[model samples]
Target: MSYLFIILLAAVLVYIIFFRKKVVKAAEIAGVNYDELLDVHVPFYRFLELNEKNRFEKRVREFFREVRIEGVGTEVTDVDRVLIAASAVIPIFGFPEWKYKNLTNVILYPDTFDGEFQFEGGNRNILGMVGSGYMNGQMLLSRAALVRGFSSAAGKENTAIHEFVHLLDKSDGATDGVPANLQPPAFAAPWLHLMHVEMRRISAGKSDINPYALTNEAEFFAVAAEYFFEKPRQLQQKHPELYASLSSIFGQDPADGGGR
Candidate 1:
């Protein structure tokens, strides 16, 4: 029955265009089967208290209804939809009414893509990307990378979540490491300084953070976020200062394994 529902659901959603990024409110999206999908893929949703779980589901449904997710040269399963929605919801769960006002559509490629958005052929190294310029208001994800992020084989990296954090960082009208709109004004300076310190540690190979974070403050923020959410306990133990600061920034204390 769940399989049948997913097949039907995918059929309906696959044809959905951007439609101005509106929340269609077209009948309902997530349900028992979606819950099962979340339970299987998303650890954050599984750990939520019963009430919080319902709220999480509600947010996921809203995002699923709002964003137009279409496949490019691949088939999108319910698993992909749920995982993508979960990625969007988990970061902003602290802000109940928050929505991705900037993003209207998400394109799923069969695998990693190159700069030109070509998923096949050599040099296809990009796992996920948030678009800009003529391509603004869109996001792209590698299906394989998306699934791997939620699978048992996943480590501290979650490609979908990383891209969402990038969107969050860009929310304050700037792509700088400091999310002025997300974090308190006073903390912006400190956050920038902290990013520098952490980037140096990563550069020196003295940190567990991905070296890619050293690319810039923006990348640092996104990379650290993946670490924060993926292994909160480990982050808390190994990098308590980072954990505390991130908890404040995101309004989420995942280290405690509970919702805000």
Candidate 2:
């Protein structure tokens, strides 16, 4: 790698470590109140029962302890951190011992960014991305998309959760779509078969799942997860096999009492 790139990576790593220490200290002293804000803002949080909510809160706290969240050109808020943590926790809520070891930090841009990672000027269609190579162990999210994803009117397309699912898919060493860490060995063939069948339906314009899923196997997994978590009942009714597969993989069945 170029000396300049190595220096930049080192700088990011240093800042993340420092920021995490500060957050942990502040949390211990002040005791962050995730309830009022999470209840007021997050729909998924509200859908959870008292016990599940407690577990969710604990997981969110654990997320803050393990990973750092910082704004790129914007300021990160308590609400922002909670929402981001919720996105991470939602996909893995099924796995009590699960942790985002592949992700050490998240960078929230003010809005959409381009291929060059510029938030202004160039094409900015990308809303969220999992960093790789020199940027591995980090994630980028658009502030606008993050907020909207939690909004009641946002529908099944949750940008933040979608990216986190990609991270989950990557936990097994690749983001090829079959999350070996989460799924059983018997799952690979069945899931791929289901994925292809669904992709064909999407291509024919007959699927309620997003067409973005047709992009690739990885994208399909992420997009399907957004639907699974956002509209569990609907997804369960419409796509029983896919929903069942995801339920087995994630362990939580939001369709039934938040699947605690």
Candidate 2 residue pairs in clash (backbone atoms < 3 Å): none
Q: Which residue pairs collide, candidate 1?
A: none
TM-score (all chains, Cα) for each model: 0.88, 0.89
Model 2 agreement with the true structure over 230-254: per-residue lDDT tens digits: 8898999999999999888788788
Candidate 2 lDDT score relative to the true structure = 0.90
> What are the RMSD figures for all models against the true structure?
8.3, 5.2
lDDT of each: 0.86, 0.90
Model 1 Cα lDDT, one tens digit per residue, 16-46: 6433234333432534377788887799998
Q: After superposition, how far is residue 37 of candidate 2 from its true place, in Å?
A: 1.1
Question: Model 2 shows how many backbone clashes?
Answer: 0
RMSD of 2: 5.2
Model number with the top TM-score: 2
